[model samples]
Target: MPTTQQAIPFHLAFPVHSLAAARSFYGELLGCPEGRSSADWVDFDFYGHQIVAHLAPEEAGHRQTSAVDGDAVPVRHFGAVLPMAQWQSLADKLRQADTRFIIEPHIRFKGEVGEQATMFFLDPSGNAVEFKAFADIGAMFAK
Candidate 1:
């Protein structure tokens, strides 16, 4: 049985145009450590989760979006919830790197339930990725 104190790890597999680009984006830029790899796919330790990038150009990138909080949020995306400071640091790092943001780092739902600092950006293959943080973690899932 799983313990409440420890969240279970998750595995995600997504398509990428090129394995080299995935390595550079996920491994070098995002700092996700590389794991098992083969000619067609590569895995990264994405913040304690397993994320595999398979070589499939036609299946990559996010096309549709949904309106949310006055922003066009990608319809299909995945991300992690970091602590406040860590989120800030990553935001700063991405800024310094001149990464193009889908949604620039900002606090949403201010003074309301589930208020959080969040950002959205794309990987080299145009996969939308989001990173967010909550000042009060308990508010994360609150309505």
Candidate 2:
């Protein structure tokens, strides 16, 4: 729907220990809504992308974290930069759902370059997703 140039909406698969827990985390907690679900795998609409949670307990703890803005960000994370209005709506929805956040939603660089609302949270499968929004799209690449 005329997303950004780099936003064609891709598909991804991640490992999950429990399907039911993953479903609750993505479907209920994050409110991703459901797509296709099975005993070993489940598909979810992750911010307009297709994400499948495959049952793979062994791959659960194999992720590494990298330093980012003084936080240990997951090395294999994915998310999107939603519009400001959508960001606020999602923030309220997350609050209503009592979503546990890895990084609380807030402005990172207030009154500076790249100022935006950012938040990090993990699904039941331990996959990290960071949602960010830029009030001024031009500031996305400011220095």
Candidate 3:
């Protein structure tokens, strides 16, 4: 069994086309609590981590991909690993909201690296975000 790492919350700052869009997506839709902000940027509580969205439409959105398990996984993206139920709930919520998925929610590496469910979608600014879960949390990092 693998041991969990000491959780030191991470901070990330990314580009967004619009602050209002980012707020609606990360705050209202995704349910990430908002934090400090200015005219140029806004911070969101991304599952205990700090992610600041800065106004930079030119820099927003992912453009490259790398193949992974037969999927064109976004080369640049960020997300969190959730519990199975939580992941499913969020997936349902997104679907109900009529979100356009980059990759629909589904199990990956099933029976190989344990049952892992994952999904990918874009924020209003076109920034890709992924949410996933592993049936066996301890095996998340299995090699």
Candidate 4:
């Protein structure tokens, strides 16, 4: 018999203009817990995945767009998929905080096979992050 392998968390490291800003955005705002850190970088438990913010001012933010669903989606970005309720709550919280959005929260591909609630915003360092939720997670990869 073949054995099934367990899923493992992913690790991502990206540049940030300032560690303090990164902490405030990913930690205080997004609520990701702080992990190990050094003078040049910090790690965060980003919704069960590990993401590191490394201080590299020159490499912080770059903008590129690709059209999708009639939206100019950011070409360089990172994000997570959350449960619907959690995603909604977070969207509300961000709105209450007066956070500027690259793309406002909305449902895309309405009534389609892969419809989902999604929002996009840039952190203080100008790095784009997207959060999305699906009504049916089983349809995540549906065709």
Model 4 gets an lDDT of 0.93
C-alpha lDDT of all candidate models, in order: 0.95, 0.83, 0.93, 0.93
Clashing pairs in 2: none
- lDDT per residue for candidate 1 within 32-127, as digits (tens), equals 999999999999999999999999999999999999788899999999999999999999999999999989999988888999999999999999
lDDT of 4 by residue, 1-143 (tens): 33224457889999999999999999999999999999999999999999999999999874799998988899999999899999999999999999999899999999999999999999888889999999998777789
C-alpha RMSD for every candidate:
1.5, 3.0, 2.2, 2.5
> In what order do the candidates fall by TM-score, top score first?
1, 3, 4, 2
- Candidates 1 and 2 compared by TM-score, better number: 1
Pick by lDDT: 1 or 4, better one: 1
- Which candidate do you rate higher for TM-score, 2 or 4? 4
Error of 3 at 18 (Å): 0.1
lDDT of 3: 0.93
Highest-lDDT candidate:
1
Give the C-alpha miss distance for residue 122 in model 3, angstroms: 0.7
Worst 10 residues of 4 by lDDT: 1-10
- Pick the winner on lDDT between candidates 1 and 3: 1
